[model samples]
Target chain A: MVLTERAREHARALVRGLKAARIEVVASVPDQWIGLILEEVAKEGSFRSVPVAREEEGIGVCFGAVLGGKGAAMLMQNAGLLSSGTGLVTLHLLHQVPLLLLVSYRGTPGDPLFYHIPKGVRTEPALRALGIPYFLTDAGKDLTAQVCRTWTYARESAGPAALLLTADLFAGEDVYP
Target chain B: MRTSRVAYMQVLADLVVDELVVCGLGASARYWKALRPRPENFYLADSMGQAIPVGLGVALAQPARRVVVLEGDGAVLMNAGCLSTVASTGATNLIVVIFNNDVYEASGGQPLPAAPVDYAGLARASGLALATNLEGADAFRSALQKALKEPGPAFLCLRTAYLPDEPIPAYDMRPLETRLIFMQSLGVSI
Candidate 1:
């Protein structure tokens, strides 16, 4: 499914876009596809990756980091999104905090984990409920533009945005191996 | 240690040597529902167990102020894994005060597994210094006051009661916005 290649390409594109925008101080919970990009972001020495224990906490940290004159990004699974719904609704969204919320799309079409399916299928719907906007990366899409678009939306909305990455992006070999 | 939650907040506000991060569900949110004067910038509602870590990040970012986290039992239990990081990190100026009532009161008072779990012991196990579980207002005041005086990355578990059917006080987001605006005005950053 070209998962690894797509994920790597998307990750690199996101880093480049964020760099071009002079955005740094990203925060994220550990995830699959974003791990490679996070390592890259770390190695670039431009982004200070704040490792958070939960996705919701990541939002609060991101808010604080942004107010401290740095932009932030977040990565977690779709279920993590559900787990953080309250924070997103009240604090991040209501308070108008901007950041990228990249969600690894597990339990989608061919997800192996049985439990994640419900939230996986509800990702977009859930985002809609929280007034969050989101986009996704496919192997064939313009990865950099998509990343930049999500970042721009996050900036303009003054709230959170999501970039959903498919499993193939992580499993693919070219970038993250 | 203090008698009421409001009193605890008042003490913390008076002794709150630093900025604050408070997280909880519906019931706990009521603590700040009335919004007395304080330095806390709470990122609450829907997110439980996230305040301490948020406070940790704030501590790392702005080390000058003491960062206090006002957390509830259910909230703290949800992300109890975070306590280890709190203990292991460079948060010399952080404090976590847990208002433990022994149930998921926000979700209708179902007994939490934390009922059997000694959170203060767990905090000690997580390598936190000054971990103690206390009940009653007097114990809260003495313990909390002493805790404030010491140099610490401390944890205090206050076993309080079901916040009785006190009507959910009316709260407006304006107070919070005012604090944010005030912080911005003071060049304190959000």
Candidate 2:
């Protein structure tokens, strides 16, 4: 199914914002909430799209992209955050590789998906525990500025940062199963 | 038909020409660092199963340059999903050389499963352009030559002997220092 107009605009803004931040590579695993955003990212000619099999692999890809002198962003859902904990600690955190994680905040309040709830509850805690800073954005928030700031903070700190996209951000779109 | 892990790494190191080399944790990193202690070579100290994806990224970002990943069998098993990703992305300039000793040499000399996997087959199944299982120095040399000359996301599974004999010095450099040098070598302004 095609994305709604609001969802499409949000995705486009994210893609454009990342490009403005000089993000040359976008490595991602598909999530229902961010699927259209990932597609928009792929269509951006300036950014090289890399679709990985898993979240940890995307983290590794982003690590290498930064090492090669290009900025990188990883897009995934909250469950992917748990899958990427090892890579987050050992690679990005340890080596001070700056990675922008554009995570879909699944299982947040008002979301009906029960399986994703636990991960959503733990997402903020996990980010805090790892000492990685994050900014949670809802539909009402200014996402363009938040995304750019997240990129800046990650690059400046030489660590991973997360832009948690709330469920409401994909409002009017059929993202849930 | 077995090959020394150190010898194999040394041979491949000689073959590399200004390519970004990423070494997985454990013996792979140790041997590569010992052979070629250069700014371009990233010896990942702790992240297991990350070497290939990192190399794939470098290959993607810098399409003109070659990127090599020297990974251990156990480490690759930790993130074997990367194999399919590498194939799917179709980065032709990337080469993955697995030092398949079939043992966890870093933690202890524990034997892996007796029924060894067909890694070359796995790579081929995963959609790499070229995949081969090589034993002895000649076969490996030949495969490396072919892979270098050809356009491919290639995979080479090298049968190595599990040698815990040579206790190398611990890696002294910090991760930040290595990162700086590597980016500088890549001509990427930090």
Maximum-lDDT candidate = 2
Minimal lDDT window, size 10, model 1 chain B: B181-190
Q: How well does each candidate reproduce the native contacts, as fnat?
A: 0.22, 0.75
Q: Who wins the TM-score comparison?
A: 2
- lDDT string, candidate 1, B1-190, tens digits: 3345665655555555445545444555556545543445553555566667666666655566666677888877778877876776646777788887777766667887734779899999988967898767667778777766666787888777675564545444553473375346336542
Please compute the TM-score of chain B alone for each predicted structure, in the order given.
0.81, 0.94
Native contacts present in candidate 1, fraction: 0.22
Interface RMSD measured for model 1: 3.3
Q: Which pairs of residues have clashing backbones in candidate 2?
A: none
TM (chain A) per model: 0.84, 0.92
Number of clashing pairs, model 1? 13
**Which 10-residue window in model 2 chain B sums to the lowest lDDT?**
B163-172
Name the regions of candidate 2 deviating beyond 4 angstroms: A1-3, A173-177
Cα lDDT of all candidates, in order? Answer: 0.68, 0.84
Q: Which DockQ value does candidate 1 get?
A: 0.27
Q: Score residue A52 of candidate 2 by CA lDDT.
A: 89
